[model samples]
Target: MANKKPLILVTNDDGITAPGIRALISVMKDIGNVVVVAPDSPQSAMGHAITINDTLYCDPVKMTEDADHKEYSCSGTPADCVKLATQEILHRKPDLCVSGVNHGSNSSINVIYSGTMSAAVEAGVEGIPAIGFSLLDYSLEADFEPCKKYIKAITEHVLDKGLPKGVVLNVNLPKLKEKEIKGIKVCRQAKAHWVEDFDKRKSPQGRDYYWLTGEFINEDKGEDTDEWALSNGYVSVVPVQFDLTAHHFIQDLNSWELND
Candidate 1:
């Protein structure tokens, strides 16, 4: 008897040709059949945005013609790619949908603005087990070798155990040497945010325009947070839920009187 292979869907916000997605595709190939439908260009910080205002494009492409996977380039957001993969690309519902291997961190508050996580969340809405992986290193040429093995292990675990409905994993790997990696930790998102700074610069027209810039501020010192785990050389896996309702606060709001 042979083991049943899982069908995997791969995507990234950093475009179809990015090294991040390539690394992810290579790792997934070892686990199951991979079908990639990724953005044609970098769509970082796009959040859960979908392309509804214009026509979308998706062309079938062979990322690596080896005996493992098939790929496609999508002219839309990360969320768009996931929808296309589910509807037109894959023959049936995928066993798993993994997004990113993002070039930069999607930790803490940044997860709300990440195109990488959007793809995974989109899959989660469709009842597919999903995960989004990120590396703390933001440079395009940053070393990804340290993440390969850990990625494989995590993917295998999710494929075997399966994920909770309406929930998905957001995994972040620290930028450390392989030997320096402590271990993996299931954690919560830290209370952190970017202190926004708008860099004012004059263009050729002498009009000032702003380029957004900011620094990450980690206010939470909890040991169980994703920030703590990554800082201490551990892979952080945070279970993310899509329901945006603040259930605990709803009752309190109803108790207040309205001036209207």
Candidate 2:
């Protein structure tokens, strides 16, 4: 019997029309039947937010006249898109879910605030094999050609060998030419954070507002980390889990004299 094509859910934080998602959709079409549910506008660092305070809107959108995939634009976060897709859009549970090819890097601690990885994490929470892809470049016009092969390879591997429950992949590519890329590296998330600076400014009406900016600082000097992989022109793939429980600390907590 011939095997049925895999059903792949596609999404991103850069909106339904962003070049990043478009590039992702193109690659996914070659591998499976793709259905995209993404934010109508950029949702970048929205994390795992969902719509609870206001009405949620999701409508069919025509990305291109000849595009093959089914696409929907939603007035919600990336995480919400995954939830809605599984609950409201797809006829059956998808075989796999993939998010991003995000315009900016979602490596290290940035994953905590990344809408891209949040969508993938949401899928993992629902027991779906998932992955989130990002490039180190932040330019709107960044070339994604270098990532196509790696993305397809990783996606194929996940489909062939299903991921463990609660685990999703975070894949980050370097901003290098295809030939310049060294290879793929499976690694751990690096210990890093942003040193933030808010620029306070006054509008013409004298109202003050702040613009957030930050410098990324890598505190880990370990070579077996995602930061190191990307720095050396390799694609970094980190397995991420949605469970935030500090299970290792529980034993120490039990030893504390809290009962006294």
Candidate 3:
């Protein structure tokens, strides 16, 4: 008898042609019937943005023309791609949504600026279990072989166990050889920040422009954080939630005199 397969929606911020997404697709094919709806161009640091001012478009692309999976290239943000997949592309709701085998890390405070994480978060908001995976290396030619087995394992686990409602997994893998990778760790996003330094320069016309640059600073020394895991050569999975309300602070604020 044939095995029952899950239906997975695959997307990424690094455009459809990115090697990261290609590696991701290769793994998902083993677990499900995959449908990929990804941006036509890289849209890093888009941070949950949507294409409100412009109309969105998607065209089916033949990545491997003879392959069983269906893929599309979309002219929109990562969030827009997820919206299109959920509302317009798929015939039914997907069992899971996996975003990003990102070319760079989206761990710690970087999640706030990540198009990768935002796509997964969008799916979580629509009540789909989601995950975003990234490797610590940022090079376009970075080897993803080390992450393939772990990625497959994690995908299978989520499909089997299912995630908690409204919570999506943000997984970051270290850029180490497969043997060097210790193991997986369920962790929290570290309390960290980027110290921004904009490089100011002048064009030939003497107009000033700024190029964004930053260095990451981890304030937390906790071993139970994504940062610690990556630094220690382990795959980190942070169960991220979409709720931004500080429920613990509501009662403290209620005691304040507002009309005094």
TM-scores of the models, in the order given: 0.96, 0.97, 0.97
* Candidate 1: residue 78 Cα off by (Å): 0.3
Runs of candidate 1 with Cα error greater than 4 angstroms are: 65-68
Q: For model 2, how does the per-residue alpha-carbon lDDT over 88-161 read when each residue is reduced to its tens digit?
A: 99999999999998999999999999999999999999999999999988998899999999999999999998
Report the lDDT of model 1 for residue 98.
97
lDDT of each: 0.93, 0.94, 0.94
> What are the per-model C-alpha RMSD values against the true structure?
1.5, 1.2, 1.3
- Candidate 3: deviation at residue 148, Å? 0.8
- Which window of ten consecutive residues has the lowest lDDT sum in model 2? 1-10
**Candidate 1 at residue 187, lDDT?**
95
RMSD of 1: 1.5
lDDT value for model 2: 0.94
Q: What are the clashing pairs of model 2?
A: none
